[model samples]
Target: MSVSLNGVGLTHANGQVALSGIDLQVSSGERVAIIGPSGAGKTSLLRLLASNLRPTAGQVSLLEQQPWQLSARQRQHLRARIGLIHQAPPLPPRQRVVTAVLAGKLGQWSLVKSLLNLLHPVDMSGAAAALARLDLADKLFERCDQLSGGQLQRVGIARVLYQAPELILADEPVSAMDPVLAGHTLSVLNEEASRRGMTLLASLHAVDLALTHFPRVIGVREGRIVFDQPPATISPAQLDALYANEQLQVLPAPESTTQASVQIPRC
Candidate 1:
């Protein structure tokens, strides 16, 4: 099993409940997409899986180990096996793209090697290859601040690809890209995950993108799972209920780009 959550709950220090009773399971090499409204606890779920957040209740298992149960040092080692891609990568503004990409392995690298590589990248070829896969090879030496949002997102993905972790968790990874590029990047992610037999779980705002790329779809709403089904099995009525917003009627996840989008409220 790649992930297992049993009645898991998370309440922040501010006392805002982000998730409650989130019971989920994913097999090894399974690729799943999480779709939901903006505040539906999608990010919280991913953070919980990434070991960035501790659950307030219930049990959480990642890669067969309980993250919170382990010692801090042991948990750090466990974290090295998981690749986390954020919506906006937390990279230094003045850092070069190569340095940023190479940092992906710092978690697994020895202290001396990590420090030396920070000063002078030891494996420029590997970083370049990863960037090349995302069409960012030319920007390798450029500072991160010089890149566009979409470019930065790709850089984050490149770092994960280079890291080669057993599991991948991405949160709204392509929100800044154009439709076509977003589609392409997702295709790349799916391809890489499949090729490497890496388990992938991504929270996506683009419902069409989720339907197009992922075979399994999980619908989250108001910190709970509304439905978990294949794209073809999901109904328009179910979607309408999941994203019911009182303010304005809006589009539900379309079956395909060619199909007319379903009408619902804002997610």
Candidate 2:
């Protein structure tokens, strides 16, 4: 599967332009990262690609289906095929972790089964296994409200794993975690997505993490794409220049040169 955007632009309800004349394509199994300052329209771009927003002009296509062309049912079907991870994991606080993870399978399951599982959570084994992949097996029965922010993020990932979508859209999936946990979480995501040959598109504030984790990187500024390159090809100076105008904080230099400690803007 693939996603293509041609001359696509988005303007807010109050006439604030968020994206302008964007043209890009994401192919199956490609891992792409979007990086930029806050309010640079990073989220807007993802929303456009995910078909959550209609372009004010031009076209947005996923696979062979046009975003505006598809029927409501078809759009839902297409969306169900893509997995999304938000910057802040938003699971129901009162729900069990296992039940939250099981919700990922709702798109494929029958309505009766979904309702039945919601009440009793019959397929705890699958949810438990998915959690195990993220080293959260013990938290299966824990309430979502009790899990740490990092733990909640892992649960979100576990849901995506269980859903097994063809495309994974992760918006700073580990921004709230410490560096060690962030690397581990991203590694798990990359490994799982690679195994399934799924396309992974992520929007991240961590320049270093984007460079370290993603093969291809796209930069946005004022709703315009400024840079799109491979990690190795992009220099630190270039990154610094990219966010020079924004008020930001650089991470403390890394302990070792062997590990990437690319500074990210605090925004």
Candidate 3:
């Protein structure tokens, strides 16, 4: 199994219960999408899988090893095999795209080599090739701040692709892109995972995109797994119940505008 979460639960320091009773198992090369309303614990679940947040209850097994049981150095080594694409990538604003992408392998490189590479990118061609996969090859030398939001998201993904991890976790990766670009970006991610037999799990608010791109869909609501089924098997009624909010019904719908808005999880 690429990931296994058994009866997993997390409680924040401030007493916020982010997740509870999350039992999930994903095999190698499986592409899964997590969807639900905002504040429904989607991000928390992804963070749990990425080992960024430890569950206060239950066990988390990644790549057949219990993460919490591992030593700090061992955990660091394990993290090198996982790739996380963030919603807002934490790239340095003034850093060049090539340097940013190459930093993906810093965990695997020697400290001396990593510091040297920071001064001058060692694998320019590799970074460029990764960027080319996302149609951002032209921005290789541009500062990260120069790119648009969608472009920065792509750069984050390219960095992960360059890392070539065994498991890929993404959170709202395409939220900044247009519908067409979002579709294309997701296709690239799915294709890469399929080609390399890597495990992929992503949390998305766009219901249509999730259904279209991923074969298996996991619905999370109120910090629990409501349903885990194939895309075709997920019914509209289930989605409605997952995102239902009484407050929205009391309000009137806004007038249609020419400018398109990203698909929000409907209630």
Against the reference, the lDDT scores of all candidates come to 0.90, 0.85, 0.89
lDDT of 2 at 255: 36
Clash pairs, candidate 3, are none
Q: Per-residue lDDT of 247-267 in model 3, one digit per residue for the tens? A: 222122112211222233543
Model 2, 51-162: lDDT tens digits are 8998998888886688689889989998888888987777899999999999998998899999999889978899999999999999999999998888999999999999
Question: What's the lDDT for residue 199 in model 1?
Answer: 98
TM-score of each: 0.94, 0.93, 0.92
Better of 1 and 3 by lDDT: 1
Residue runs of model 3 more than 4 Å from their true location after superposition: 246-267
Q: How close is candidate 1 to the true structure, as a TM-score?
A: 0.94
Query: 1 or 2: which has the higher TM-score?
Result: 1
The CA root-mean-square deviation of candidate 2, after full C-alpha superposition on the true structure, stands at: 2.4
Q: Write the per-residue lDDT of candidate 1 for residues 68-179, one digit (tens) a residue.
A: 9899999999999999999999999999999999999999899999999988998999999999888899999999999999999999999999999999999999988998
Q: Indicate which candidate wins on TM-score.
A: 1
User: Which residue segments of model 1 deviate by more than 4 Å?
Assistant: 246-260, 263-267
After superposing candidate 2, which stretches have Cα over 4 Å from the reference? 248-263
